[model samples]
Target: MAKDHYSVLGVQRTAKPDEIQRAYRKLARKYHPDVNREPDAADKFKEIGEAYNTLSDPETRARYDRFGSDYRHYASSGAGPGGNGGRWGPRAGARPGRGGYGNVEVDMGGDVDWEDLLGGWFRQQAGGPAQGTDHEAELWLTLEEAVRGGKRTVRLAQPDGATSNYVVDVPPGVLDGQRIRLAGQGGPGREGGPQGDLLLTMRIQPDSRYRLKGRDIYVDLPVTPSEAALGAKIKTQAPAGTVTITVPSSSSSGRRLRLRGQGMPNPRGLPGNLYAEIKIMVPPSLSKEERKLYEKIGSVSDFNPREER
Candidate 1:
């Protein structure tokens, strides 16, 4: 039995176009083969797309609603929805020929082209070129590469044990999960039709030194105890290059210093800010002179960090 389109999309039969579209998008995101690894996820995703394609269109929805499961069969048979037939059976006055079903007269009212009917429904033309299918692939980029956009060579494996290389132009400040489209670079069209597009989903590789949150970047800045106690200018790493930053006096761990416009560069708008989180480091082993100096300072100072706030 053909699955019900409404049931496949988990939407009511009376769902509006926007409601159906929303359900399709939600299900598609959950069941997309690229994101979901379950064995049946690909099938479920395809089913959802099919349901959306049918229900989203007013004409297709009307046909499906009238003919139920046999809509395609009835439509391709040159029988209108109001034809003198029950579902997909023959007309009321039709007589069974030899073998009880050999000859059946279908009142098409005029000369009908079966090929044209089926082809039109499937978005194809008889003896004509057809557009190719669009393709999607993931493109992984390092944090540095994402920050500074450039041309990258992408190698895609074909089904026939061959590979094709394409140079992709990545724009700066492209967020993770964003898509870049390459026009007419997908599967070849049939009979010289226009080729489809290739969509590349961006996947930013993780970096140990930094963490990204939207356009903002967070990085741990290791500072000596002396530097923290007394304000000092220090050099640190940024996405583009090393930059000198100022450390405030008496700064503690976890204190963030903001460097405006030092993060991911945005070609469209304002650049992101880079935050340097302070992490004070102490000497592993102190020499005799250092120990004496610390002891002297400890004796002179009456400050107690363990005191109640």
Candidate 2:
């Protein structure tokens, strides 16, 4: 049997929200497809992600606790009341042809798709032409791709039991949870009605280079001792390309340098800014001359960084 949400997250059923989040972050970092090379890393990551999403939301978590995974929507549609299945069919005098609706019967005795079952009942009660239900799926993009916008291809399982491919035209400045719509790409309409849409929700993959907040980006800008001491112009990675920016003299770690309009671009309006934080680094190994020079400077200078401490 498959693992439950708590099992997947390595948490108890009574785990607190913060505890759940902590466990999720630890597992995500370890199993993330981009980070782990294990054969099952991608699948495990997806499973944990689904587990975290379900457990993090109170309403959904309650629903899951009550009815298991199918409780998502299926169980709710099961035999509305008193276990009498449901009332679903075309209305009387309704046209049945190419120009109008048609008859598509099913044997709901053994097994059936509850999603389709619910849709049919809804359509019959509406007493009018109804479009198919919209489908939702997630699309993961790299940090660079989310900023630049490009063609991303996705393969989905069609209603007819076949997988089809589509090239999504991702827009620039896309962020996590942003929805992109694809018209008439979802479930097929019944009785010649128009098809529904497919919606793709964007999720920028976790990047080690930068952190994102809305439109702005934060990145670590490493500098050598000389560069931080005397100031220097250094080339660094930006959302768009490599750009040179100057660091002020006597800079310290955690100092932020802003690059205006160098962040995610907007298709409609002004772009966001990128903030580079200074991180001074020293060479791990030193040559004889380099060691001598450092010793001399130490003897000549009376700088005490630990005075405050």
Candidate 3:
């Protein structure tokens, strides 16, 4: 079934722009693929991302409300979400062999002077030679690498037979989808103009064990029913390492435990907190002795959990 974008974000169709953004942020923090691993999480995240990308822009939002599913075709045709042809797919007249998504060539305007645009304005005034075109490339990184800061060596595949690797040092606290730049790494200088920069669009790898929400990290921590009932300090593993966590006595399942400074760091250089959500494990079968003990305890305990409900 096609999902209603408003319903997916838990917002009414009449929701204001800010309201829609807030709803998306709230739900995205919950179901983002990096944080959620349920079978439907990735689909849900993509849906949410698509919805946000469309509704966040005024022109696209207007067209979406007017056209609904049919709007997608229009949106992909370089209408509605203008300049997003790469995200939606190739442009209307893209060549069969042409690539997009940073490879799409745009004709700025007939008035645009190629030689002037390529070189500094001085060269343009003097009618200098056509400048070298800017080269584009992509770089992928892991979530942990983006968070903890690490060094990466990327092998650049140039058109020529020669291949070279560039060592890149990623700073701590980098967010997903953030771009980095390398000066003078683009096409060589043309007509005495300096070479353009190399732009790196980052794509963070998916994590299996951790989910990042803004600056917070959430992990499901399994606990035995007894552990939930009569709390104990048990050792648990964190992304960094193993650490002992104390489950408060009489705690219930789904209780969240906060570990300060255990999450991804922020731009301010302070690490975010980690949240452990408790899930009580109940064995399907019980031993004879266990059953007998439970029966005896039930006979004396008068714990009718359903009485109130």
The root-mean-square deviation over C-alpha atoms between each candidate and the true structure, in angstroms, is: 9.3, 11.4, 15.7
Candidate 2: residue 199 lDDT (0-100) = 88
lDDT of 1 by residue, 278-305 (tens): 9999899999999999999899988787
lDDT of each: 0.75, 0.74, 0.65
- Better-scoring candidate (TM-score), 1 or 2: 1
lDDT of 2 by residue, 9-52 (tens): 99998888789878977886677665578988777877877787
lDDT of 1: 0.75
What's the ranking of the predictions by TM-score, best on top?
A: 1, 2, 3
Off by over 4 Å in 2: 1-126
Instruction: Answer with 2 or 3, whichever has the higher TM-score.
Output: 2
Worst 10 residues of 2 by lDDT: 74-83
Model 2: per-residue Cα lDDT at residue 93: 29
Q: Which has the greatest lDDT? A: 1
What is candidate 1's CA lDDT for residue 88? Answer: 35
Give TM-scores for every candidate, taking all chains together and pairing residue i with residue i. 0.62, 0.61, 0.54
Deviating ranges (above 4 Å) for candidate 3: 1-136, 159-162
